[model samples]
Target: MKKIRYVFYMPVWRKGQWKDNFIGYGIAIWTFALNCWKPKMWKYIRKHFFSHVEMWFPDEDGKFITMTPEIDLEPFAINSVPQFTGQCFSSTMRDAQGVRFALASEVLRNPRRWWYIEATVTDTRYELMLLLAKRQEGKPYDKWGLFTGFFMLAPYLQNDDERYCSDVCAWLAWMANILPKRLWIISPRRFAWLLVKNLNRELKPLVKGKYNGKIQKHSRISRCVQIR
Candidate 1:
């Protein structure tokens, strides 16, 4: 059996149109900088975007994070796409179709900054993703998917704006809450579309730049997808 694990990170993507075609870099930049202060940064971020955050803590890896109780909602985009089978995500509901999921310890967002989830994962896809991020080996970004059973959060829609979070980031976060220890099954296709939706024009400006690249790659989802 072929085994491959994928890792992903954000604000990471293919080169876009402008020399600096960030959807909203200044905002995310400010937030990343402010995150240095923790309490004040958390307070300021919650004021505008989050409806309510559920958890916040520091991990063994020195990653301090806050968790938000994910709102129970399905993704709205796939509603109209018939090609997508019955589910908010085609990869999730189908059996034998391998989808990747990361265990989330927190939900952090800033209007002009970022929306992130930190988790542990195993049995993932898209090896190319990590090779590109240049993260440390054995770090969260270091492994790919497998039957070995590990989990971690990859990239997510950085925009948790009040109007969009429900459809964009909350469902995945909710999924993480439900299956905190199991492989959540990340789908490259699903996340690729996520990037498309977040970066496209006509959508309200959530951040500053277009995030690019594969969220995760599918090797042979046949083994994982169930015939439902």
Candidate 2:
């Protein structure tokens, strides 16, 4: 059996330590339970441990860049793409166009808010994944689909038109041929569980630290930590 190797980093909030342990294409999981405002639907009701997930890759200059679909109300542009307004929420539903980019350093400013998981990918696949992710630079966030699909109310609502955090990551993996086929709709916690279950290996810290991170050995899911 091929073992998938991964390094789990503790929530130390040290930029220098994170910089020294950078992986060109690494996946980061954000635990919303850490937030002061709780996501009642995702956490308490649905029982999901993770709130969001994002992937990062190094640019030509070797600077890491993070990509994630979020509910941004700001106007932004990427490359030759015309400037576009981001997602907006009204009395009813949310508007489209929520893809956002940021320097890895900026996103990792509060390492305590996220759990870093570095997976091994081949050079060719890494390049392909980066290319595929860039193509979604201006995609919209699937606000409605997130809830509907999760509850199995409208599975057909799952499309490429818009994507949530985990949807984007799953789409990229499918597009890059890492996954056999697209996972239409998946929660961030469910996705992380799948990865950990399929990839047989012991979890260890990426950097030496006095603080230790723990993951449930039976379920392979990390306990959510409250930030405040």
Q: Give each model a TM-score.
A: 0.20, 0.52
lDDT of 2 by residue, 14-90 (tens): 35655423321122222332222434334321332345555655444433222323332456533221111111110
Cα deviation of 20 in candidate 2 (Å)? Answer: 29
Model 2 has how many clashing residue pairs? 1
lDDT of each: 0.25, 0.44
lDDT of candidate 1 over 1-228, digit per residue (tens) = 111111112332226533223422332343344333445335334333322111112233333322222232566232210010111111111121222222221111222223323333232312232232222111221122211112233222221221111222223433333222221322222232233333331212222344231121221111121111
lDDT of 1: 0.25
**Backbone clashes per model, in order?**
50, 1
